[model samples]
Target chain A: MGSTATAKIVALPMVDKHADPEPVETKASAAQMSAAEIQVPEPEPIPTVSLTKVFLGLLGYVTRERMITALLACISIGALFLFWYLGTKYRLEFYIRFKNVPTPYEVYQQLTQVGLSNKYLFNIAMSVRRILLGFMIATIIGVPLGLAIGKYERVRDFFMPVVEIMRPIPAIAWVPMSIMLWPNNEASIVFITFIGAFFPILLNTIHGVHSLDGVLVRAARCLGASEIRLFMNVILPGSLPHIFTGLAVGMGVAWVSLIAAEMISGQFGVGYFTWEAYSLVDYPAIVLGMITIGVLGLACSGIIRMVGVLLMPWLAFAPGGRR
Target chain B: MSMTMTEAETHKGFIDVRDMGVTFGANDNKVVAVDNVSLNVQPGEFVSLIGPSGCGKSTLLSIVAGFVKPTRGEALLDGKAITKPGSDRGVVFQQYSLFPWLSVRKNVEFGLKMAGVEQSKRNTTARALLDLAGLLSFENHYPDQLSGGMKQRIGIVRALATSPQVLLMDEPFGALDTQTRVVMQEILTNIWQQFRISVLFITHDIEESIFLSDRIYVMTARPGRIKAVIKVPLPRPRTAEMTDTPEFMNLVQELKGLIREESLAAMAPEIKDRGLSGFGMKVGPKGVGEIF
Candidate 1:
């Protein structure tokens, strides 16, 4: 067998990359006598750290293509700022009902001044508080309700009709009714925010549960998991990815509802400040409000994403962390 | 060893199915999956059910695993009726059996945890089983990170961690590549030897059934019934080298003939239905004859 294998290797001079290593070693087949003589190569020596390796390690898989896209995004944002400066510098109106738009510098100047004001900070805090309160309540009620609705046909049938009816009504449309229903202005605004947050969370949770593989449930049962155990071990974790997605989407809608409600009836929120600025003809404050809202919303979603990553460590295993 | 051969053959088994039949729907829409199938697995025996597709081999295994109810007959495990799934019977599904959310070790320890076993004992048992599968190094890895063969190995280990009376595998190697499938077969045989538990294996692979089983039960086409039960005369501690010998090849040839006959018969009706779809025309020369 050894002689025949040697003869074959001579006959076939080129490398057979696809050849099974068990029968013949790749680089050392000529030196080997038999399959058992196929030796394992020694592990490569650890080399001193290279700058490129460290750089790549710090930012795994940041392809040149992605960098190009990031650069383009930055350029577009720069052009927007330039256009705002140019437009206000000359007071140019390029149609589309353009008028009295504040210059980028004017907005920046206003932001610098308002950055330290106690009333501005208080308004931001108040808005954050209302949004958090509403969202927390929505999550507590919606997740369990969604799980029940998804798990049982009876719960689904009972709740679905009412949800469907209420789902399509915009949160702003509920402003009049919410004001009448709630005794206080704060309660009305929070109610609107809750309405915005609840439906998406509920629907996504239901979808998450419904879409779980039935085989997992069967596997759990055969493994001796009781019904309650099955729910905890299989159903909960199985549907969590979808639940997080629901939460992220719900957060965005909640902000939109919260801002709208505050504009309509709020006395001391960021939204109310923007509306007050418009009433008092303070144009720079309006742009400041928009910037604040955008920054706050991004931070809110970022926190949710961090929480999701922590909860689902398996799915979010960073490159070079654990393979 | 406690029971006589005759008694084990006729009365008791780790997994026993008696005149089992499962059918879905009613009236015109009805589909008969299994028809009057009966089989038994003695303690420490390895049994394989080989048949054409849609031959109810999986349905039979599901009955034994207590996933599906038998429509016409009954299945029992250790003299107790198999009503619903329990930890007494461990099942390894063909694919996606491992929980994606759990690490390999956690997946293995799941049944132990559910059984209310204490934390330390559960971890030790899971570690031991993972070691048996030669997967102790990959314990922290999620199922998503493992290859097809590795995932199935974890699946088997997870199933065995519960220490069930019988291990029910449903085409566990069907989705694997040819090379991986062969390796998985060897690993399974090794596990079976060490564990010494009854296994009711299901597969369509003729060579696989012959290589792994103490007895191979061949089933007919739809409304599947036992067509033959050939006891493997091959010696224990079977190896890949045995496949080249006349005995193993002869068994493979014999099983292949039986299966091909059933497979052709199974495809014949469907081929005709396809021909009928062409405006009730007769099947031309480009019909079932050319189909493998």
Candidate 2:
């Protein structure tokens, strides 16, 4: 045991790159010289790290991650085909109806027709543009207000009751009021979409700001951060993850509400096209529209998640480490 | 021991505490954490406050770092009362307090940035301190990517960045395993010698206190008071080998004995007797024997 311990101590200097040789030698010899004459070694100089190494490591990790995601994608595609085949072969009314439900090939034909048209594509683009513009406008208005509500109890109390009454009223419920209020139908859709997003983002921002760790705030204060610096450096950054959560939820709501808002107004959009297809009994085109909405919603949420990854890398290492 | 107080007084005390105490809660429910403890620290002195949990060693250290204000008494540095924390006093918390959001280099640069030190100077100082802590290779790595020991190393470098006049460490290596703890001690000793800054180290580990401090102050539990101050006569830049020395062992034993006594004293029941419990047995009495 004694010999092993000594060997272990001796082995340490080899692995501990931080251990210096000269003073260790002096300490080793000084024990023989006198009891009081011993001195520990100076610390070894730390080694340098190259940025290229970090970049390579990150690249390797990302490649592995992408490979796993690709495998999952293949598995999902297989599952979808199996479900479709089983539904068609069984001829259960649920399955038979699904089979009669335009086949992927039939849907593809209709989608290609609609998707290829510059006018149709332009209408889809306009709907997307309105949703995004309204969402952006809501974020600009809501985030700061949410922060104020979150940080100050008086602000929360002052606005909370009014917000609560407004919150329960659906975005579509606002279409009549918005149409009456705004000068144009375009503005009304934008207004309804903005209302759809504004509450979730605002409420989330308030919660985010309110939920910030008091210890972290105190830590910043102790580090000599002024009030403005503390808000910018600690509060803003800390609350961002919550803000993003709000944005993602809000965008989903905005996308869903935009179709309603567009239908109420009956303009040239994906919603308008779907209503027109239904009037003409063009069921495949209707299905195509629904699929398009679902895909766009998925894409928008994915963008929010990707933005989260870019903006707050720390969120990736949180205890759950899940999106 | 030769006095450095004269030299220290020329610039005023590095840190001065007068009848410092902290109380939490309110009214009848109030609990005192620290009570009427005063200590003067000079520039370049390594002082360790050793005590058990709830003894308020950390509270005392926090007060000195200006993270907390004492209900009574004032914490002064260079004769100036500390109203709030500044770059002049840097703290290393026990649980590896590196900012998880930042890279090792950025964590170290945080203090420099707060102080408004130019980017070039911040880079130079951050690099030097990381090298000193043996974490230079981990400069760009985030805290989560590093091991516990490596994280603590970055924590030390972060605290050291502003060249703080006093370094306050609250059980800085308390979570590390034994072997890593020893290596960290050696690293801290090396850094202390090179920097020559005053340190207020809080620890419950008696042996760790013996290893790193110029003087160790033992504190009693709950509403802490300084029990005794033991001067560590061991020479500077203490090595792991010194831990096996007769003198070092003797000091460790002494601290352990004192700690054992303090623990028993703190745990002793407020009542001298348990009334009728002692009536049956005559070996002594039911409440006679103490923990020590």
Candidate 3:
């Protein structure tokens, strides 16, 4: 394309010079001269940037709102640390002393101690594995069942009552039943986590499928798509945004149930670590476990969001999207 | 080209609506949406259906597109009944129904892909059509990235991508602004000139109907049936300047009168029930009725 433009520029004056005779000589030569000048000069290399200017340029990109947000976050975190310090230093009240709340510095020291210990890493890995396994099981079962119920009224009618009845029962409440049903503590804990994750994913998937644009389905039909093709191409992709919402919510719930189940039944997990700390009166270790759970939950939800953005570039390009 | 000649002789591209009627609800609650409507489009002819709102213009278009079945009669394509939607009859809806999930080029290639056209071939064909519609540069963009006009253009090209025998458009440009609609009309005209596919376009706009169609089928207000089949005496390769001519204005005026009369007739029952003194008072001096 670039070569064609150069060829056109070179050819235009030659044609003008040949077609008209009077004052074309200087004009044609001038055009040729400019074209030659353009061809002769190479593009300049990118200039090297000084360190201070580069730093300032990077700093300039951070808007005032972002700066304010960062400042507010820092102030809030600082306030939390100050409150913790004062509360622990003074032994504030009965509940605070009974709970044995640790100072931020004590918790930080405990975190470093735990980080150095192999048991702490093992507990984290075990907890993460349990959550992932339970979440995957829930997704595999929920997505297909949800799609069926959403797409067909008869299927929905058959399953909706059963789902509604079972959904409200808390994962902790299922601990006794899961223990009786399953052969081992591992299976029971996983079952509890799966129960926690399943409802959210299923409900969200149903909502996603229900909210699919009727025009999209009709348009697919008009395009000569068969039933299977319509489901695969239109229905599945169209409901993706809602499905991602479900997955993210489900991941949070799965972790919640996994920890609860671990506290009651587990031998080696983060929840077990926290429960043991409570029994041993290690307040700082308990705080370390709580912080670990919070950080892990955030990371897991962030990963789910990233996956959603990857699957739906259209959503990424939409107004107010992360992209 | 010779195949089209043979098909023309055999009425291949022809769309025949034989006493087609559609009713909704049951017994006492029944509403006659389209009443014994009959119309036809000849091979390679552009026909527009114009009527007031609630007059089942879209219902009629839907019948031809095979989305809705006629309660009584049937719509035929090349003497065969249209029971379900197929690639044989391509439809362009009032809402630009381009798939939001798909890119512009992929949306155009959808029907072709459904027909099991090889990937490379469909891609080439889609690219050519997009290029013709001046949307080639936006091939990678999703439908959400496009303006209303650009999306409608993509809708048109998507419908045409399959090379369907008859193109059924339901007020394809109704949602666009006046300037965009005019440009779209010209683009549609150019496309029609090249393909010469039989079209049954539905629109309430009198001037638009007169501008694009070879013949216009005017329907009654409710329980829509053919009231008039006005033939446009205008020449093809129609430009925007043609709409300013005496002939175009005369046709517009004539259509306005027909529509106004039907619209009034449709509202007569309501007017009588309300005991409004003047029957024709609601109609403005410009011949535009507010019934719609």
lDDT of 3 by residue, A1-323 (tens): 23433443454344334322212332332232223223222322222355367657756765666889899999998997788788888878854462367888889999887877999999999999889889999999999898889899999999999999999998989999999999999889889999999999999999999999888888788889998898888888888888989999999999899899999988889999999999999989998998899899999999998888878989855657543
> Which order, best to worst by TM-score?
1, 3, 2
| Candidate 1 per-residue C-alpha lDDT over B124-178 given as tens digits, one digit per residue, 9 for 90 to 100 | 8897666555566567978776667777878998887777778899999998878
How is the predicted docking of candidate 2 categorized under the CAPRI scheme? acceptable
* lDDT per residue as tens, model 1, A1-323: 35544543453223233222222222232222122233332322222355367668757655766788899999998998888788788888768423688888889899889867999999999999999988998999998899889989999999999999999999989999999999999899999999999989999999999998888988999888887888788888988888988999999999999999999989899899899999999999999998899989999999998998888888754334432
Per-model chain B TM-scores are: 0.90, 0.87, 0.90
Q: Which residues of candidate 1, in runs, are more than 4 Å off?
A: A1-60, A63-70, A317-323, B1-13, B274-292
> How close to the true structure is residue B288 of candidate 2, measured as C-alpha lDDT?
47
lDDT top scorer: 3
lDDT of 2 by residue, B201-286 (tens): 99989889999999998999788999899999998656667889999999999999989877756654532344223334234434
lDDT of 1 at A320: 47
DockQ of each: 0.28, 0.25, 0.18
In model 3, pairs of residues that clash are none
- Every model: Cα RMSD to truth: 6.9, 6.9, 9.7
The per-prediction tally of clashing pairs is 0, 0, 0
- Report per-candidate TM-score of chain A alone: 0.78, 0.77, 0.77
> Which ranking of candidates, highest lDDT first?
3, 1, 2
